[model samples]
Target: MEMDVVAASELQRGGWDVVVIGSGFGSLFFLHSYLKRHPDHRILVLEWGASHSRQWQVDHQTNSAVDYQTTISNHGEKDWNFSIGLGGGTNCWQGMTARMHPHDFELKSRYGVGLDWPISYDDIAEYYDLAETVMNVAGAPDAGKVFPRSAPFPQQQHHLSRTERLIKADRPDTFFAAPQAKLTSNVGTRGACCNNGTCSLCPTGARFYAIEDMADIWEAPNLTICTGARVREIDFSGPIAKAVLFESEGREYRAEADLIVLGANGIHSPFILQQSGILGGDPGSYLGEKMLTFVEIMLDGMDHFDGGTATTGFELSYIDGEFRSRHGAVQYWTNNSFLWGGLRLDPPGRHRQVFPIGITVEDLLYKENAVVDTGNKYPVIEHSGFSDYAMKGLDFAISKIPEVFSSLPIESVELRRVLPTADHIHGSLRMGDDPTTSVVDSSQLHHHLRNLLVVGTSVFPTTSWAVPSLTCAAMSLKVGATI
Candidate 1:
């Protein structure tokens, strides 16, 4: 049955089997995985934005969403509501897909800074393989062995651009293979990437957005996708989530289900939890804290040497305990190269016409400063500390850019401002073995509500260097199978 878009107040209690909030890759993966495993279970997903088509571009960009309110962080309307329409962030993502390493799961025990995950790398290795297969990553293997390995990526990394090749030869150690969601060959229902490099607003779905991948599941008999809807909170009676309150088209609706999956992104998921008044009153609370994102900055004067995949490979030289990179996670993509992705900073004067190579650092959000309810629709994120780490990583990466491009003037290298956005933001309503500390369990079940579960980066305890979409999808699959 097709998902019916309704207002938050009008929804009949107990109307759904599983009610999923959010349309990003997290929700898409969970919905796909659920319907794949249990055909009889009815799954309803709610997205705040429109369908993933060119008409939905909020900023006239191809695949980007254009119709939402602008915020302080990302410049345009593309930075709309945290959770919108069918694809979620996957709709606007640059498609740099990779799995979180084993070490990432144990950052707290090994590094003694953050908390260790309830699960480990061994638990999700195969799922990474499965995720890559699903995403259809194109690239050659990391010959230098930078990222942890389990199986060969479904497709080798995409070919580097001519400028990228030159930079690699000029500084072989500085550059790595670019992993992307675009296919080199037909995988599942998608085709090869057209290499327009206009992937951000891919006019065509060839780039493998999760929504496009889930098109089949949308057609499936068991799953229903409800778009143009916004989930306000999970309605709980005592400890059990009996329904969800949401609004759409200036109206209200409620949905009740045996199982409720919260796939809202890292920010909004916690906003919903706190707003529901289910999990509150814990300042030192492990739940709704410790969110992570790769803090990225664009070097101002670095030559725009090239373009292609948004992310090449990353370096782990900073991963070891002795590395003075920072207490939180930090990995540098080869953004110093021209057009190869070091400049993602949108300067105040250059928003309409310039693109910079952006250097992204997997900055860990310290438990000290993370998302907390400020009694608003969104969580108040303390970003001062993480901002500092991002600057440090940008400095480190910029210092080496000239080594790869001697033609580019070193002194002319202008370090521009940083962008406060993240494609991999995870960790809000984290899952754990205990409800006292976590909002959900290992099975993705809500701690207080037996029926309510969340599957997304929000459930992650520690943010890893790899993109969270694949891991989030993997966990969602595990959860969906149970339903």
Candidate 2:
């Protein structure tokens, strides 16, 4: 299937009903929901990267032609990672679909910590189910027991790993099969996961790639996709975003729109607003994410790599409770990536001994951490570091290492140094009711500029202890319903 890509020069006389910047899950899901409610509306999507097809990505063993470092100026110790192509982060995500717990929405109210989201989990619960079905999310049957859901998952649960099974046997209420966007069964051209361990570029196309799965919006008669079009800033005076100023093939162009959606990732979306001089409540302030950590444990007797996919089960044991009153919450994604995987088992019976658990600690966004534009194409990413709250969560999580895997005779649990980036960025242009505090409204529309909406994790006031993909999609889907 050929993408209906429009050339930049052919459409110099630009005018569109809706002009969305960035072609990520936030953008596609918003468009997917919007077009469903109001069909045949003119929509134009501006993506910074070219359309690198799925086959090309698998064949070349990469996602994009552009290097990630080349696009941004890094002034901090850590690196911010995200795919820049048409499908955006979906190209590189591990496909762990999760919903923010009810407490995540009311941090300040429930725990006297961070800001509370104007909306609650109950508001977007329907859309979470909608997105799950659209992606054919194969989740545990009892996931609804953990997080409140109105509907069951579209597909059945993935088989839990041996270590996970043992952990669940010991702590059944705390540990459960993780909800992922891979397939237990095939649907259309997409195949079931073959447990290749490399899900970033799924050779079987089992994971939900935006280009393949989100074709409802991409191939709609109402939408036009323009690749290699980098939006510089919005042309707006006070409340209205009149036009989008962008560059394509060394030439700058202005595309007028009735409504403009800034679906750019967490960092760039605020940078775009800052460059455009819309700085109420500091759209460039408080830019950071929950710190990413990996905790690995060597099992004794359990032969582990039996999951249907890479990361099969999840542990919500440390996610909530009174600890959140002081320290941030923590969540776990049990991964199958060992330092020495199935390839080289030096010992005769050391086939599946290494059990790696991916961990994320909830964080408080600091005013010092921010994204600033220094008159460059990309914004400079600078950070002070993680707050004491987040560090304490990590410390607490590490303290529970022996207990987390106590079912098995735990040999050792090591805290490998924190990874550079989890690709879960947040808290730039956050949502709230007050214009002096929040940049966007509860509906994700700008407080002052009502016509301009900022979608994706950029509007996330607080980062939860899970991947931001599913939450961001739910927020975008809600935006679509309101608009």
Candidate 3:
């Protein structure tokens, strides 16, 4: 099918009803749901990176880098590993689609740490159902109770790999098939997962990426997508965003819209607000503050090197319960595929049995940790050290390594500390009930600017110990319906 995307030069000279920046899951899902209600409304989508097809992504490994100027301090000189293409990080995500635990929404009320979300799990439960159906989620029916789903998954669970089965056989309650966005059977134009084990670059399009899923939306008569349009700033007139200034092909252009939505991930969204001078004083203080991410811990013990998706099963018993009182929640999963190709295992025959169990600890939000623009060429991400709660959680998770892996028959389990990378960067433009504490309201709209809305994980008040794409999609859908 031909995509109905145009260049900035070909854009029509008229104001759009809505201008959505970025083509990630949040933006696409909002457009998909919003257009269904109001099909004749004029909508324009602005994407910074150029589009890439599945064949092209496979041929290129989907690693073609873009030259956007952004940096991370206290970690590295380079910027966070964020995708800029049409689908953004969905092009490279692991496809885990777990929902945030109910306790995650009430962090402050339940655990006396972090801030509680303006909305609860019950508020977004229907949207999660819609997002799961649209993404064709596949998972075991047993996970329904633990995940608190409103409806059954659209697709049946994929078969567990031998490694996952082995782990589950030993510890039944500790492991279950992970809820993933990848399809198990053919759905519309997308095919079933071929189990090539390269989900980051799936050639078959079995995985659900927003760029591929938004093809029908792009073809809609009411929508227009402009690729390679890098938004520099939102020209605000008083409290409303009057126009979006962008650069394409080394030339600058402007697009006017009555309503503007920022779906440009966590980092860039605040950076854009700072560039536009909208974030200052109280809002600016909280703009890039309270950043959160997980500390990755790798374990060696299972045999999971066969052909399968990136992750088939996960452990969630430790994420909540009495653990939150002392430390944050901890989540672990079995890595089904060996993406690191060049690692040598101890002994010759141990390579097949040396699988990795990935552990992720929930991060507490801190006001001091922030992304700052020092009037330099690039934005500086000044992140402070992890909070005491987060450290306690990491330490607790580390202490449980021996007992958790004792069920499986393995030689030894090792812990390796990798360089910290910002995988799930959130809370730069967080949403809350109070304008003094958050940048946006519960509906994800700016408190001062009524017509400007911020979607995606950037608006998350707290980062739960789960993959955030599903939650982001749900929030976008809720906001779309409200609009």
The most accurate candidate by TM-score is 2
For model 1, the stretches where C-alpha displacement exceeds 4 angstroms are 1-14, 54-59, 62-83, 142-150, 161-175, 185-191, 280-316, 324-329, 335-357, 367-414
TM-scores for all candidates: the values are: 0.78, 0.97, 0.91
TM-score of 2: 0.97
Write down the lDDT of every candidate, Cα atoms only.
Answer: 0.59, 0.84, 0.75
lDDT of 2 by residue, 1-483 (tens): 666798777774658999999988889889878998878778888988999888999999899986877877889766788888998988988888988898899989888888999999889998898889888999987777779888889888888877778888988777878888999899899999888777889988889998898877777887888988988889997678899998999999889999999998888788888888888888878888888887767667656777767888888988888888898899888876652223326467775777878889999987678888888778898887788999899999889878777787777786777877778888889899889988998898899887998888888899889788898888788889888
For model 2, the stretches where C-alpha displacement exceeds 4 angstroms are 12-14, 339-348
Q: What is the number of residue pairs that collide in model 2?
A: 0
Scanning candidate 3 in windows of ten residues, the lowest lDDT window is 287-296
Q: What lDDT would candidate 2 get against the real structure?
A: 0.84
Candidate 1 at 415: error in angstroms? 2.8
Rank all candidate structures by their lDDT, best first, as comma-separated numbers: 2, 3, 1
Q: Deviation in angstroms for 466 in model 1?
A: 3.2
Model 3, span 97-145: residue lDDT tens: 9888888999888888778999999999999999998888998787865
Cα lDDT tens digits, model 1, 1-483, are 233444444444457878888777666776666777678877777776667553356255545453433311321211213435567777777677655666777766776655678887667666666677777767557633655567787776656644456556664653566566777666655656655556666654557676556556767766566666777888888867888888777888788887787777676677677778876422213322211223223334543424445454444444434332353344455432334334334555432122234444555544544556666554555444343544554566556555534533333444554544554565566666756667777777776677777777777776555566677877766666565
* Maximum-lDDT candidate: 2
Alpha carbon deviation, residue 227, candidate 3 (Å)? 1.7
